[model samples]
Target: MDQEDPGFSAVGEVAGDRVTVRVSGEVDMATADAMFRAATPGRVRAATLDLRAVTFFDSAAIHTLVRLADHYPGALKVFPSDRVRRVLDISGLGHQPWVSADQG
Candidate 1:
């Protein structure tokens, strides 16, 4: 979202009724807000946050994902990188309702 920080980058594109967000770089306290905002643009029937490019993830990012899951239910989904997946697993949030390796 903010180009000021080179450590984080996120982009979103609408596809039909769903939005697909591609997020890369660190997601820490400094970048979580930008990541969240990029992942969720507004109300939508379905959405997907693809974190395959993310290199770092932290507690703030985890909390943001949890909140997104709670707010969007089945409409919200996430595809995380191996590093991010480990963080989710360690945090016990990987198997949550909105996180999955495959949306189908």
Candidate 2:
């Protein structure tokens, strides 16, 4: 989904100390900023980003996640798929502690 396509969107929820971000369709540069802010739920000891619904990801998405992790330090837990994981790995964002959604 592209910017002009207008079918992409991001939704989020938080349970306890973990935040769950569920994204649908493409998450490109244009949509990253809003998604990042939407996913972020202020100061939490742990964050569980649920990416099971994200159909696409790009550097912007990866960078956004990294920035959040950097901001919070050792308090970011990401749940991403293979495509999303590739972005995180390439961007060195996967080094952060990752906790399974079910674990929380």
Candidate 3:
């Protein structure tokens, strides 16, 4: 599924048991839910969130990511942009096993 807002977009690609959702633009209260929904479609063994293009991320975005991490457990991986990384670091979530600067 693909979701688009004025300054945000989330597009998902599925391969076998894994779903990779690429998110761009600003992620705030207005777009976080949509991003979460787009990231998780039905049931998948694993999920990858690519937020390297996200220019802005807020608390709502963080909450959405946390929810997704919980939903996918150890199967969730997040590739964060520098902007998102700063927020995640400040929020103490950047050190999470799910979060990685490397694309892998």
Best by lDDT: 3
- The segments of candidate 3 whose C-alpha lies over 4 angstroms from its true place after superposition are 1-4
Tens digits of per-residue lDDT for model 2, 10-104: 66677787666766667778888777776676855555566766778888877787777776577766677667766667777656575233323
How far residue 34's Cα lies from its native spot in candidate 3, in Å, is 0.6
Which candidate would rank higher by TM-score, 1 or 2? 1
Model 1 Cα lDDT, one tens digit per residue, 1-104: 44335857878898777888888889888888887777677656677889988899989888888877776777888888999989999998888767776623
TM-score, candidate number 2: 0.71
Q: Candidate 3's residue-wise lDDT over 49-86, tens digit each?
A: 99999999999999999999899989999999999999
> Whose TM-score is higher: candidate 2's or candidate 3's?
3
TM accuracy, model 3: 0.92
Ranking of all predicted structures according to lDDT, beginning with the best and ending with the worst: 3, 1, 2
